[model samples]
Target chain A: MGRQVPIVDYLVLDDGPPHLVAGRCRGCGALYFDRRNGCARCFGTDFERVPLATEGTVRSFTIVHRAAPGVPVPYASAIVGLDGGGLVKANVVHTPADPEHVGLGMRVRLTTFPAGHDREGTEAVAFGFEPA
Target chain B: MDATGTVAPSDATAGDEVWVLGAAMTRFGRYPDQDLIDLGAAAANAALADGGVSMADIDVLGAGNLYEAGSGVGQRLQKQIGQTGIPVYNVANACATGATAIRCVYMAIKAGEADMGLAVGFEKMGKMGLLGAKPPSGEAEAFEPSGRYGSVMSVEGRLGTTLMPGVFAQAGMEYAYENGGVGFEQFAKVAEKNHRNSTLNPLAQYRKEFSLDEIMGAPMMAYPNTVLMCCPTGDGGAAVVLVSGERLRSLSDEQQARAVRIGASVMTSDPWTEGDQVQPDVNTLTRQAASRAYEISGVDPSDLDLVELHDCFATAELIHYDNLGLCAPGEAGKFIEEGGPERDGPTPVNVSGGLISKGHPLGATGVANVYEVTTHLRGEAGDRQIPGARVGLTHVIGLGSACCVHVLEKANA
Candidate 1:
C-alpha cells in the first residue's frame, strides 16, 4: 500500500481519487470533499479545490453479506465522521472480525484498495476505512 | 396546519385506566452471531416476567422486524418464550415497525381480544443492506438516481443529497456557514455529546466515549458529514408487555408502578406529490398522531416531559426538532446550539442515545424507543433516566416517510 501518487495532500486525494471528489458551495462559504454540483448550504453551483481527511470517527458501521455490482462482497462498511464535520459513507478495510469491535465512536482511517480491473484493462481503485 | 376537527368521545380523567402489566427487551445493538428468534424470545421472557404472567397469560403476540428474511426468527423466538399455538407475526413499516407492533398490541387489549399481549420487534439490518428498501413484495419498483422519495412531496420540494449523509452534509454545511463558518469541531461536539450519553446506557450498542479530536479525525464520507454523523445498521431486539386493567391489580409494586397508559397512537404515510421537504406531509403524521394522542390522553406537548425521535442523521434530528413543534420552524440549528434537547433541557430527545449514538437496527428501532420511554417512566433507567419523568412520547416514521407517534402517561398521573 505504498506507491507515491500525485495526490493534492500526500495523505489525501487532490480531486477525484477514484472514490473521492471535492464539493464547494457558492451560497455559503462551505467546501466539501464529496463532489456536490449544487452547494448543499445555499444550492450554489460553483466549486473549488478540496481533499478528504485520512482519518475520522466511526459514527456507525455494519458488514454486508450481499455484494452489488460496484462494491466489494462480504465486506465491512462504516459511516465515518471526518475531523472536519464532513461525513463519508465508505467500506471498512478489515473483514470478518468481531462486529462488536467496529462500533459507534470507534476510530477509523480512510485508504484505497484495488476496485479490480476494469473491462478496458485499467486498474480501478475505491476507498475504504481501517481500524485507526 | 389543517386540524382533523375530530373530538374524543371521552374527556381526560373520564376514561378507564390502562396499564402496562408486562414489558421486556433483548439487549440493543449488533448481534449477527445470535439467531433473531432467540433474541425475540429473550425479550418476550423479560416482558412476561415483568408482568408476572404465565405462558398461558400471553394470549397474543404482536411481532415486527424491518428485514423480511431471518433464519428461524419466528419459530425460534416463540419456542424459547411462549408455548406453541401463539400468534407470532411480522410487522414491517420501514423504520416504524416497532411503533406499529405496539399500536397493534394496544388495540388488541383495548378490544378485549386478550387480557395480556406481547409486542416484540427485532432487527438484523446489516443482514439486509441499505437500499434494503422497497420490500421485495413483488410491487413495481422504480430506480431513480435521486435518493429522496416517499412522504408528501411538494412542487417546490428541492432535492438534497438523497443518499442521506449527502443531504445532511448540505444541511450541516449550511448551518455552519450560517453561523459564521463553524468547522468540523462543531460536528465533533455533536458526536462527542451523543456518544457520552450512550456510554451511560447499559443496553446501548456502543458503550465507549469519544473525544473531540477523535471525532474530528474520523473518515469523511460526505462533505460536512463525517463518520460521526451517520448511524450504520446494527442488530438488536426490543419487546413490550401489555395488559388490560384487570391484570395490573396483581402485579408487584415494581411492575404496578411502571404501568403507564398508552393514551394515543397514530400513523400516516408520505405524500410525494408536493415539493416541500423530503416529505412535506411527513410532519402531518406526527402532528395528527400527537393530536389524537393528546385528545385521548389530555396531555399536549406542553404537558409532556420527554421524547424520542428518529435521529437517523444529525441534520434529520435537527430538522425534526422544529418539525415536531419542539421549536419554531427552520430553527433546528439554533435549537441544538441552545441546548433545547440537551440532557438538562426541558425535553430530552434520544435519552437512549438515539440511532445516532445507539446504532439503528431498523425493524427494532420503533420498539426500542418505547422500551427507553418505559424504563424512564419506571425510574429503572440507570444513568440515562429523566428525573421523575411522568409523561413521555415517541415518534417514528418510515420509508414512506410515514409518521407514527405514541404518548404514555405515568401510572400515578
Candidate 2:
C-alpha cells in the first residue's frame, strides 16, 4: 500500500493530529500559510513555524455553481477566521451549498478527506472546513 | 510635500498642467480578425486624428495591453502608425492597464519629460469565460504531494478560487452582511441601469436594454451575479493624447476648446489590512485613489457631473459607489434604490453603459473609461450626454490589485 500524504506542504499530516502550519512572524506576530519571503506586516526576515487553529467562523463565502470543467460545482467557497488567529481560504464541505446551510459567522472545523490517488497508489489528502 | 514625502511639483506655483487633447475608443466587441497591434494602431490614429495632431507631434507612447505586454506593443503599434523613436512604455496592471498607461503619459507631460504624449490600452480577449488565474500550460506534471502548490488533485475543492465573479460575489455579500439593505434585487438593478444606458451608447458592445426582471432571471454565474450582471469578455481598444499646458496655447482656438484638463491622475495599490489576505480588498485602494484624486483636483465628489467606473460585475459597481465616495458609507444600497446613479440622477455613473454593457476588454477598459468622461466633459457625448457636464471622474481597478482614478474637467471650467 502507498503512503498517505498531505496535499499542500503547509498541511502537516504526520504531526500528532492533522493540523495546518503557518509562518508566524517573529517581529509582530503575524501568521501566513503559503511560503512567504518575509512578513508583510512587519517585514521581519525571521519566521517561526506555528500550528494554526483547526476551528473557525466563516467570515465570508460564495456558493460557486459554476467553475472550470471537471472541477465540482455547487460548493461553498469560503474565507474562515481561525478562532485564535490566522485567516484562510477554503471550501465549506460536509454541508449543503446554500445560504441556508453555510453562511457568514457559521462555525466550522478543519477536516481532511482522500483525493484521487496518483499512479503510484499514493493517496493525496486535502483539507476543507466542515460544519462543527 | 505629498504623501510620499517627495518635494512636490508645486502645482499652484509651477502653473504646470496636463490636458487630454483628444480621446477615442473603437467599438468594444469581439473582433476575431484584428490583431492587438491593428486595434492599437487604429485607436491611436483615431485619437490623434480627433486631437488634430499626428504621430510626429507625439513625444512618448504608453501602450497598455495585458496578454501581449511582453511583445512591446507600443513599438509594434508605432510601426503601423509611424516609426518615431519616442520612449514607449508597455504596461500591464491587470484591468487597470489602460488607466495606468494614461497615467504614464500624464506623468511624463507633467514632469516636463515630454510636451505631448500618447496612451493607448487594448486587449483582444474573445469570449473568455469567467476571468481567473490561467491554468498552467504544457503537459501535466506528475503531482508531487509535497510540491510548491502541492498535489494538483489535493488542492482542488480545497483552496478557494480567484475567479472574478466569485471574488466580487463574496465582496458584495460582505458589504451586504456588514451593511444591511442589500440583496439580489439591489444587485440586479445595477445591471439593469447599465444595460438600459447601453441602448443609448451606439459604440457599446451590447446596446439592447434588459429589464430588471430579465436581468434577475438570467442564468447565474455565481450567487447573486447572473450572466447578465457580469461584463462580457471581448476585444476592443481605446486611446488618448495628452498635451502640456504650454503646448495647449500654441494650438488653434478649436483645438484649445476641445481640450479636457487633467485635474488629477492617481493610482494606488492595496495597503496592508487583515481582511485583504482572505478576500480581495477592492475597496481600500479605490477609496484611497478617489480621495487623493479629489484632493489634487480640489473637486469634491459632489462636484462630479459624471463617472465611468469599473463595473466588471454588477456587484462590483454597488460597492464602488461607496468606495468612490459617490455616496456616504453604508448608503450605496439607498444610492442605487433612490436612482442616484441613473442617467438623469444627481450623479450619473457609467453613462457609456459601463463595462457591464459596454464590454470589458481588460486593457482597453481604463482608457475607454477616460474616453467616456472626456466625451462628456467636452459636451460631445451625443444622445447619452449629461447636459453641460464640466467635471467628471474615471476609475478602474485591477485584481492583482491596483486602482487608478482620474478627475477630468472641461478646458474652460
Candidate 3:
C-alpha cells in the first residue's frame, strides 16, 4: 500500500477500523479529542489516554451550501453525541446532504476517507459519520 | 493583605455615576476606499461635536477593533482625531469589541479615573466574510491543538467544512425539532421584520424590505438560513462620549440635557461545559450577562421600552428573545406572532434594524447599538423613534464567547 496519514493527530490509522484518540480527565471524566493541557471541568491536569466510541447519534445537523475556501460545499455537518458520553462534530457522509436524508437523533458510525493528497502522492485521511 | 487576611475594599463602585454625553456612528455599509483610521476619526470627531466638547477635553480613549487593526491602532486613531497625550487602551472581544470599549470608559468615569472618556469602535472589512480567517500567528497555532479557538481550521477539523451560518442553522433546526413547532417561516419572519424596520433607518446597510415569500425563496446559505437572513459583512464605525456626573455638572446645560445615564453595564464569558447543547450553549452566556445587568440596573425586562440585541443571524435574534428575557423560553415564535417586538408594539426591538439590516461591521456593531439606543433615549431617532422611550438595553455576544449587556435610562426619567 502507498503511504497514508491522518489529517489530525487525534485520529489513529491502522489495519483495523479507525479510532479517535482523546484525553480523558482522571478527576471529572471529561474527554477531549485534541490534546488539552488541563481539564476545564475539574481543573485537573492529570489525564489518561482513551479511545472514543466509533458509533454515535446525530443530535443536530445542517446542510451547508457555502463554506470557507477549499471546503467542498453542500456537506452535512452534524454534532454527533457518541455512545459513551462524548460529542464530536463531523461530516455525515455516504448519504444525501439534505434534511430528508440526515436528521437529528439519527444513528451514525465513524468512517474514514481520503480528504486530499500531498504533492508526493501521499493520501491524507479524515474522519466522518455514515448512517449506522 | 490585612491583619484579618482580607484585602482592602477598592472603591470601584463609589457614589460616582457615568453618563453618555454623546453618541455617533458612520452609516454602516461598504466603504472600500476608507481605512480604519479614517472611520475611527470620523466617529470620534462626530461624537465630540455632538457632545459640544473639544478633543483636548477627552481624558482617556478606549478603542475597539476586531481583525483589521491591532497594537498602537488606538493611538493612531486618537492621533487622527487630534490626540492630547491622554492614555489610549485597545480592546478586542470579537463581536462585543465595541461594547467592551464602552464598558471600559463607563467604568473609568464611574471610578473617577477620568472626568470624560471616549469609546470608539471601527472596522474596514473589505472582503472578509462574517466569520473571517485570522492571519497565522504563534498564539493561533498554540491554541489550535486545544480546539479553543473558533477558527475555520478548528471548526472544520473537528466538525465538517461549515461556516457560521451552518452552525447557527443547526441550532435553529435543533430548536425547532425539540421545542414547540417552529418552522422556516418563523425564521423568515424575523428577517422580514428586521428588513422592514431598516427602511426607516438612514444609516442601515439594507434599506429595502422583502416579503416573506421573497425571503423564503432566497438562495439558501445553509439549510434554514437564506442569504437575507444573515447579516452581511460591511465597513463602519461608531463612537460614544462618556462623562462622570462631576464632569456633567461642569458641562453646559444643553450638553447635560442630551446626556443618558448609564444604568448598568455587565460583561460575561462562556461557562465551561463538557458538551454543547445545540440551542442554549453560547446563549447561556447572554442570559447570565443580561440577568446581571437587569439586577444592577434594577430594571425588569418587561419594563424596558426598547432593546438593541446582537442579531448577527435571524435565528440568533429569535434565541435572544428568550435568552434576554424578552419572552419565556420557547415563546419566541409566539412573541413575534403577537407583534410584541415591533416598533409600535409593547417592546420595540431593533428599531435601528439590528445587525441583519443595519449591517455588522463587527467592532462597530456593539457601539452602533449603543448609538441607536442613545438616539431614542434622547428623543432624536427621527421617523423610527420609539414614542416616549425611557429605558433601553443593548446586548452583544463575541464568540470564543464573551457577552456584554448595557442598560441605559433617560437622564431625567
Candidate 4:
C-alpha cells in the first residue's frame, strides 16, 4: 500500500490510536460526526472538534441480507449510542449477523478495517464497532 | 392561532368543500408492454368517464411521477387526453409523489384557482431489486471528503447500509426494543394479513394467500422483514377527479351521489427531533399529518370506517397503527394481536392488500391509496367491502421525509 488514509475526514488515523472526530455544538452540546452549518436542535453555528468515546452500546441492529450491487450481504448493521453522549450508525464487526450473535444494548468499541485501495495503492480505512 | 397549541381550520369554507368526483386505478401489476402515458391515460380516462365529464371540463392537472419527473409528465399526459390548455403541476416527493399530485389539484380547487381538477400518478417500473442508497456520482473517483462524510463508496458498508429493508428493519427493531411485545411473529402476521386481504382485490399483483408459516419461512430481506413482507416493484397508474362543492351541485344526480367529500387534507415534513439524527423516525411526521387530518375533519380515529395506509413493508404497517392513532402509542403489538386491522374487524386497514401485495409502482402508490379509500367511501369496493363504510382515511409517507394524509367521507354522511 502506498499510504493509509481514513475513509472519512472525521476519522483521525494519524493520532496514535484511531478515533472518530465529531463537531460538538457549543449551544446544546449535540455531537455530530461531520461538519455542520448549524445545530439542528439549537441552531448553534459555533462548534468544537471533539474525539468521541471509543466504546458504545448497540441501540438497534439489523442483519441486512439485501443490498445494492458490489456490497456484501448478511452483515450486522447497528445504531450505536456512544458513551458520554452521541449516537452513530455503523456496522458491528467480528461477529455473526444474527439476533443471537448481535443483540440490542450490546457493548462494542470502535475498530478500523481496510475499505479498499485506490489506483495509487493508497489504502482507505473505514471504522466499525466490534464487541468490547 | 387559537389555543390547543395551533388552530385547526378546514381548508375549505363552511359550505364550499372539495369532493372526489371520481377515483380510479388500473390494476396494480407488471406491464412490460405498456408505457407510462398508456397506463396514465387509461386511469385518467376511466376517472373522467366515471365522473361523467370530459377533459374539456378540467381546469387543472397535477401529475405525480418519479423516474421521469423532470420531463413534464403532466404536459405529456395532457397530450394523450384532450389538451384543454389547463395549468399543469408536476410534482415528485419520493414515494408520496402521487399524493402530492392530488394535493396540488385539491389546493388549486380550494384556493379557487379552479373549480375542477384532475390528478394522475403512474409508473412504468419493471423490476428493480432491493431499494438501496447508491453512491453519489463523481464521488467515487477519488478518496476524498466531498460533503458530509468521506466518498460514498469509501464509507460503504462501514455505516449500516441505507437499503430500504435494512432501514425499516432497524426502525422496527428499535421500536420493539423500546416498547415490549413486538417480535418476529407479530411482524409476520402483518404480512399474512395483507396477503390474505390481497385475495379479495382482483387488481392486486399477487392474489394468492400466504400463511404465517409461509411468510416466516420466506427468504429474509432484513432482520425482521422477510422478502414476502417487502413490497414488489411493478407498473401501474391511478387517477382522481376533484370538483368544488358548487360544481358538484351542478352535476347529474347519479354523479353527485357517487361523489366522496374530501374532509381533510394535510401534508407534513419531519419535525426537529433528536432520534432522527441517527435514524429515520417514520412515526413523527405521520403522527403529525394524522393528528392534523383528524382535527380538520372533526373525525376521530375511532370514527374511521376503513383505512388505506402505506405498508411498503410489514414492519412499517405495525408502527403506523400507532402513528395513525388507530391504537395508543406502544399498543401496536396488542392492536395486531387482537386482529384490530382485520377487514371485518372494528378498524379495517389495507383492505386493498396495501403496497405489500397490491404492488408498489412508486408514483402510483400514493394516489392508489387514496383511490382505495375513496372507493370504499363510495360503496363501490365489492367483495372486500367493509359493510356500510362511511368515513375512511388514506395515508402515505415518503422517506426523504414527506407524509400526506387525507380523510374521505361519504357525501351527506
DockQ of each: 0.03, 0.51, 0.42, 0.60
Over the stretch B1-413, how does candidate 3's per-residue lDDT look in tens digits? 23332223223342376888989999999887888988998998999999989788888888999875566778988667786898888999899999989988887777778999999988888766647543322222122223432221234623563467877777666666566646678878888889999999999988999999999899888877889999999899999999887788887888888898888899998887754422226677888999998877777898788999988878778878888999878888888878878888888889898899999999999899999999998899999999878789999988778899999887531
Ranking, DockQ, top scorer first: 4, 2, 3, 1
Considering every candidate listed, which one attains the maximal TM-score?
A: 4
Score residue A34 of candidate 2 by CA lDDT: 61
Overall lDDT per candidate, in order of appearance:
0.62, 0.86, 0.81, 0.86
- Per-residue C-alpha lDDT of model 2 across residues B333-401, encoded as one tens digit per residue: 999999999999989999999999999999999999999999997788999999988889999999969
Model 4 agreement with the true structure over B1-413: per-residue lDDT tens digits = 22322223456563468899988999999888899999999999999998889998999999999988999999899888988789999999999999999999999998889999999999988887766557433324356557786543545466786778888888887878778889889988999999999999987999889989999989998888999999999999999999998888888899888988888899998886766877677889999999999988888898888999989999999989989999878988999999999997779999999999999999999899888988887778899888878889999988868999999888541
Off by over 4 Å in 2: B1-15, B133-142, B145-156
- Clash list (residue pairs), candidate 3: A89-B159
**Model 1 RMSD, rounded to 1 decimal:** 12.9
Task: Give the per-residue Cα lDDT of candidate 4 at A122.
Answer: 73
Clashes by residue pair, model 4: none
lDDT of 1 at B256: 66
DockQ for model 3 equals 0.42
Better of 1 and 4 by DockQ: 4
Per-residue lDDT value at B102 in model 1: 78
Docking class of 1: incorrect
Which 10 successive residues of model 2 chain B have the least lDDT summed? Answer: B1-10
